[model samples]
Target: MSSRPEAAELGFGDIEVGQVYEIERSFSATDVQAFAAVSGDHSPLHVDPAYAAGTEFGSCVVHGILLASLFSQLVGMRVPGRHALYLGQDLTFRRPVLVGESVRAIAKVTAKSEATSTVVLNTEIRSSDDKVIVMGTAKVKVRDQVRESVAAASAASAVPAGAARSVALVTGASRGMGAEIARTLARRGHAVAVNYLRSADKAEQVVQEIVAAGGVAMAFQADVRDAEAVRAMTQQIVERLGPPTVLVNSAVGEFANRPIAELRWSDFEDHLEYQLKAVLNTCQSVHPLMKAAGAGAIVNMLSQVVGGVPPNGLADYVSAKTALLGLSKAMAAEWAEDGVRVNMVSPGLTRTEMTQHYHERVFKMEAARTPLKRIATTADVANSVSYLAGDDSAFMTGVNVFVTGGQTMI
Candidate 1:
């Protein structure tokens, strides 16, 4: 028997229900075309826009099977791997996935038959718009009695209020992925300080919901760009929720979708203050507390736009986020010896209040531009952030994980 973690060791009986599997994969134009060629699924629906234009779907629809294949990509190498056997799958297509759309596949364990060495999982395929193009269920087999037992026990001893949940400070928790991240951290037994700058009402609502759900959370107001305010907020949070070991910098100033020619220097400075400076302030303020603890995870919200394919009017936003990547790497290098891990999550176009405007004007056009034809959702990005904040990414640092739906391949 190996002394390594269940995830690292290979065995059969270790499979357990209630575990979740997720991965963000980009499908390139070549990928779609390749899969089409190999699978002989060259329906005009998948290959030819002109042929699909007259159909009910109105355009070239991505092959459903291609999106579903992402489920295999998520688990095949990361989970049970070669030892696991795919027993069955059931898919329900909700919307047409168009070519070039980047898709994210998610699977959650719904049932288990340890005796039979089988685990059943519910699966989902979501477009960037946060719409479910397809959903289904899958079953796999694994072996490992002791690992399974531990999994079961952890599930049974669910984290309760006042219990041994970790503490996480989440900035920009008033809406979108920040709010979802706060809720998820609470659910996973983390006492959460839901931080918001201007949205006190939304922050309060998140706190209420956490408490209502039998978790511990408090709303704190602090503008991350203000160093003094951030320091003060850290003190208050420590007083309220213990010293936070997890920090998620999710605060981003709104970007005016105007051309650079139409923007002023102040607009550029404002974006830098909110996006880049805010990250710096939080990381600097939290360093002492985290170093004393000898363990911490800090995640900063970045944008995939920084990778490539600049949008119409987001130069300031893009510039600041690009700098954030460098900040993340520099912090990781400086703090790794202290056992602090820093990482960046550059989420693709997500469906949020800020994006509803884009959704109205260019959602379809944007969808057509990517391999997985859609935008990401708050939950999509939130789930990934939680994993990075959790113990799962204990070895991960200085990496910019793009949650874009196959938008920028390189």
Candidate 2:
């Protein structure tokens, strides 16, 4: 560790918009070797001087990713400090960085979201000669250390015995966006029911993680497409956690993007079962409980594809998701008098286990199309869900919030 003070030591509460931080370091040949050894990226441009000498740079150059890694150090150690999660980043390489060149990395807070405890920073790296090597923007989630402590103390003093917080049921929460939403709710003092279909072990793991973090969570298994199963699951949650006042319909089935010409009718049915039918089952099952409570929030997960379906395929998936948008609006209108608010969150090409196989291609395509120049992450979608599930959006209903990095503006 360099003699630099950590971000936590500097205190995040003292940070402000436009505040800047800088760190200077030089990447040595030894550092390059170590990076190569650890990352398995021993390319001729980085390691073979003989080959590198014939290239345009005329010398070995440090890996671009290696240079970008400096931004991580700047954010975690200098700016937001200890409790920071690097959510997303957009980088542009201005010039090649050669080993042993002293470089300065700078981060400036451009925007801050107090509701989410996240900050967006402008980032740049320059050589000692003042030549910019890399430039980009980064979004990081930081913990409000001081505020959290005060809130925790206040909550401890305010609540009465056996007075449980609101309950949130997140479906398909064994992993990906669902799991993160469950955890986020728990962190906000809500009792979370982690719903899963076949991933019992993974669901249990999510519960364990929440419990370890001092949050209340329990895993429940059910095939969301099955109405009977969903009803049983809701009953179990009611008995254990309490009636769920906030329900997030996030469970989805596998999508096969076959051309419309070759797609069979069953393909459409399959998606409907998972998307439309599942939402119907979950909503109907929880309607009574929420209606009786006099107030509740329901968040349904839709895909950005509904905005404009990709031509490559997924007609079945797109059709079903389009229907979900209408369903959300109808529910909002019908449930308004029942004191239940319904909303939708649509994400575009988010990084999740279901999309891992095509992660690289999808990321490149979506990032190029997105104005933010980055794909959405699980945390990004989770943050939107949290917003709609909480009192911040109490007056909002029948709205479709797109967490698509501006890919789907409508």
Candidate 3:
């Protein structure tokens, strides 16, 4: 078995359609004989070599049931995991499997029944050559259990909070994913400095919420586009939160869906100022503090469109993000020796207030196209940032983590 740890037991609430899990196994002739002895299917085609040699198969074949058994492992050991109980399964054998042939069994969730607490999975068994060996469907009901999404996500990467110096600075944290990143870092025991441009009230609200949750936080207002203002804000954060060892660059300009013909150079310039320039200012402001600490993390928020196909009207947004992405990689390369790691989180079409301009059909189309059958959530992006901002990713630098729910696989 792979050394990867098991996932948390999933309840109906935690399961999403189009989610997938798989396992592999190679059947041995000894295993076939054992099944033959147990099930009493001693047919020559399956057990007798000479009797089968004259037949179309030319050799003994493993029982279809032995291959289908992997689906049970898929349901019982993964996805919904230990909490799942089989409701039913329908199978269609597509090809024969000879002994010692390796096959991978895959299960993908197709539907969820809220009323019945059941999940339907499209199941398949494929040969090592990528040929479909068997195809089937399974219906499983998950046992009720509490969902611990945050805990499970952090289990792999989180360090002991009290033992680590965790001070976080999240820019544009007055609302949206930024606010959530601030809150999440605080929850992970970081003293959060919430940076905002104009929404002091919203920034203060985020700070108060963190305080109420038994976490340390403070709000700082600064125009990240101004290098001097960013440096000043860093001084304030240092005085209060002990200098930010974790910096999240999320201060971005307002997006507009305008075509090239309808746009001005200022439009693209505005995005570059908000994205590339603001990030540069913040990174410089926090670099000295992080270098002094001997270890630091920078989580740059970027968009998936920069790496994939861009929509017609989003050239400005895409261009800005592209520049930011390149800058982040360069920083990661140059700053590694200084103990400051730079990484990026690029999320797909997330349903946030900024994206309210997207039409319902467009939203649905994106979700349907995604492998997970849904758009990225703020929590999804926030969790990725948290992982990159922590000790779990200590050895990682210059990597881009995609929070796109498999929309843009790169």
Candidate 4:
């Protein structure tokens, strides 16, 4: 396994779904004997090589429970790190692990419940041959010590008094996918500016949650389509947090879905203002800050509807999104010289409050059609945005990341 990050570097807030941690060790005869001595399960198959060979033409096997214990090490020492209390585990021994064979145990966060401060991890142990030997799930409760450690780490890692940590401005972040993006960025150590047009209460709630999670964040209101409003909002963020080195243009205005024949030009114009003009306003406002920093990332949120035509009534929405894709590529090319990168994230029908009114059958059909057999969630989209916002994609620009579960492939 790779070297573990410092215990102070991790907390429940830092845990992300699909994050993996692993550790490996080779068990020896002495280890097996020690286990046998401790548990008193001195079966011949485990302690006596000759008797084991007679029965199964094999050598001594390590105790299944002994191998399973590695999971405790993984969850308690790594991953959540230092403050994980082993709640319970369910194990299934898939194959026998021979003594003297190296085994690697992996723990992956599958789900996290912030309200309860618990995380569910998928655990598996594999032999050196890369064959699974044991598989299971673990439940753990994270303690307040981890939270305190995270707060201390955040403060310790903050830039000097005059300098600032990289700030990320997320528009329309009061709810849905935008809210998740704000939280995720904060967790990743970015000071976040959560922008909302009207959801003041919800926006404050997001900021409070980030603060509670030991991250830095503040809330601001702005109509992203208005150049003056965006300028004012950006200045406010700079004064309160820092110049935004990352910008996520997720602000959206309401528009009706209507067929081209039924739609007026005003409908198309409304979407254009929402999708294209809003992106333009935020990008232009942050360009100077990014250029000064010699680096920046901009992620534009688009819709999967642009991939193909719907059955009816989405021409205006789809057209504006498609245009935004083109505009993003143009901006990428224009800003390459200034050390700014532009990208787009197109998400399929995600189950946000905005889409809750979607018919049940529509969701089921989309799920069945998707290769992953599931619809996208807000976290799923936020994960993609987080990836593009960080250094993980430093070499990438002008790319469209589809969070569609393979529903739309190009």
Candidate 5:
């Protein structure tokens, strides 16, 4: 084993913004299997060929969230280490990543915060071709010696102080899990940009709820799939809701229900276009702002299925979700030194519209078979997402917390 100090050992005095922290971790088919065994995400895109062959990609791919787990290692050990607290991250999957592929995680600190003890990182994930498969921003709490020494000696240290509210642009806030996620953030007192594709009514309702519940929120509509639109949306959110320091990517489409054989290439790309590209567009759009502000958080939703899942019809769905995992890890590596904490939450089966149909057919069996003896609720997943998005999980990044309830033991 290499004898380098953990990331926490590296002092902030020796680092500067824009410095690159590039690292490589080889992931094998067995590694993926191991992750699946521990995470309970046994989706076929990362495993079964019989299920993957009929999909548009025509090949099995690695689970996106499994790749995302690499982010924790990058942040917790490779880049920031002991001094880091994972604030949040935003991720986009640009391409399909297959098993046995050598992937790299790249991190660059783009922003730093003295008062909040944080940094914002610009992150990227690439394959051997140097093609970016995933991109996102990670907001990390770095130990600022100036602040630490002051707090340690100050007599008023016990007084509760209000730090500046951190914000983020979350897509797909019309309803379902995205809305719930937004509400969770608002309840945590975060200022939020409730992004909606076409659900103005739903988005507005969420806004009203946040306001009524004594939280801050605003509704903005953007088809996150469109790059230009995402750019415009981020700008609007910054103007309206203050610069977004945290981003939670919870957007998904209803088309995720079908199996691979019945899946059309257009349907596959459409999902990719909206779910994956939307994240890229938003992160890229907000990255400069996060850097300029000196801190930010980005959280991308990854599924346990990306690692391995029982036989299900969703080859394309699994492929896209699997791709997301790799993207999260790459960003965590590239952006950590810049003061950004990148991490991921691989949620097990959760009750959401996406799983409504699956719930009817397989959830009962899934719950019965699961060690937890129940499917994960939206709250179950959201709690972890919120923690990663806040100071509660400050010492984390480039890590994937398997919220599988012992489905996978690793």
Candidate 6:
């Protein structure tokens, strides 16, 4: 290990907007070779001078990540120092760094989040000639072990004061699990928007219930698969209540068990349209709004059938849910640094209106197989969504909470 002095740690309270810090260094060929050896990036343009000379760069170009690694040092050894945990980085490589070129990694605090204990920095690396070679934003969570632990413990029981009265949008809230989720969120101090595509009467009834219970809520009609309709409904919601900072995706179509040979490809497509397509539209529309607000939560509804041992004749339903699971993870990874979280709740067979038609034996068998000796209820799934939407799960993302009564434990 190199004998470098440790930088002073800066707490969350110590950070401020416009504060600047920088580190100067010269990268050599040996550094490139060492990085390549560890990273396994043996690209000719980075390791072979002869090959590099033939390219437009005309020299061995340093790995973009290798150059960007300077920001890591700046964050860990300076700025927020040892107290900082790097969350994510978004960068643009404007110019290449030639091997042996001297450069400076500069960091300036652009924003800070007391709620999340995160700080956003404008980070860049410049050549000796003062030309910027790389530039981007870096987000780091400033950690204070004792304080964080206490806050986390308290959050488990109550909502963060700042989250009170925040707006939530729950799709397919006309009835079923969606209605439960909307009502639960409203009880947790969120003004809710209950969305339904066609069941206007039922949606309005859910809204009226929330209002009678001294909560704010309204019904919206939109085919979530239709992007334009979703936008229009969202606009109306913003005008009436507020831009939703929390979204619960609970939209789904009716379940019809059919053999593969008897089903058309359109059958599979329809399931995807309801489950996956709706999420895509809502997420795209609300992401910018969430990013601007500096905090958001998206709880996607999935079925534990994807956990394993999928039943027969559910190819369409299971396949759509699996795709949704993957998409939730991808969105979680992409949006974490924005203080926007995406999580999935996959509950075991629940007895809602959707499954009311199933034979009594199906429910009995499911409950018997589960460790809890009972199938899930709409309340069980809705309660889990409430936890994920609240600040108690602030640091969690890219996670699938199996709310299956210990039935699908990994």
Instruction: Predict model 1's lDDT versus the native.
Output: 0.77
Candidate 5 per-residue lDDT, tens place, 283-335, comes to 77776666555556778887787665544776776777767777777777776
* Prediction 2 global C-alpha lDDT: 0.83
TM-scores of the candidates are 0.60, 0.60, 0.60, 0.61, 0.59, 0.63
Predicted candidate 1 versus true structure: per-residue lDDT over 153-231, tens digit per residue = 6534543535544679999999878999899888788888999988899999998998889888888999888998997
| Best-performing candidate as measured by lDDT | 6
Instruction: Put down candidate 6 lDDT per residue, 1-410, tens digits, no spaces.
Output: 98988977887667766699999987788999999999999999999999999999899988999999899999998978888888877788988888988999999875554335566677899988898889877778878776566545554333333445478999999999999999999888898999998899999999889877767788999999999898777766654565678999999997799977788888889999988999999998777557656789999999888887898898899989999998999999999988899999999889889998999999999889889999898899999999999999998888899988898888
Off by over 4 Å in 2: 1-164
Judging by lDDT, tell me the better candidate of 1 and 2: 2
The number of the candidate with the highest TM-score is 6
Output the lDDT of residue 206, model 2: 95
Off by over 4 Å in 4: 1-164
lDDT winner between candidates 1 and 3: 3
Model 4, 75-194: lDDT tens digits are 767867677777777777988888888999998875554324556677899888888889876777777675656544554554333223778999999998899999999888888999
Which residue pairs clash within candidate 2? none
Model 1 CA lDDT for position 380: 80
Please give, for residues 162-240, the per-residue lDDT of candidate 2 as tens digits.
4346889999999888999998888877878999998999999999998788788889999999998987788677655
Compose the digit string of candidate 3's lDDT tens values, residues 1-410. 79966755877777875588889899887888888899998877778778878878877788989788899888988868878888777677988998778899999875553323556677899999899989866767777644334333442233233423467999999999899999999888798889999999999999899878877788999999999898778766654445578999998888788989998989999999988999999998777556645679999999888776787998888999999999999999999987899999999988877988878998899999999999988999999999999989999999999888887775
Q: Flag regions of model 1 displaced more than 4 Å.
A: 1-162, 359-361
Clashes of each: 22, 0, 0, 0, 48, 0
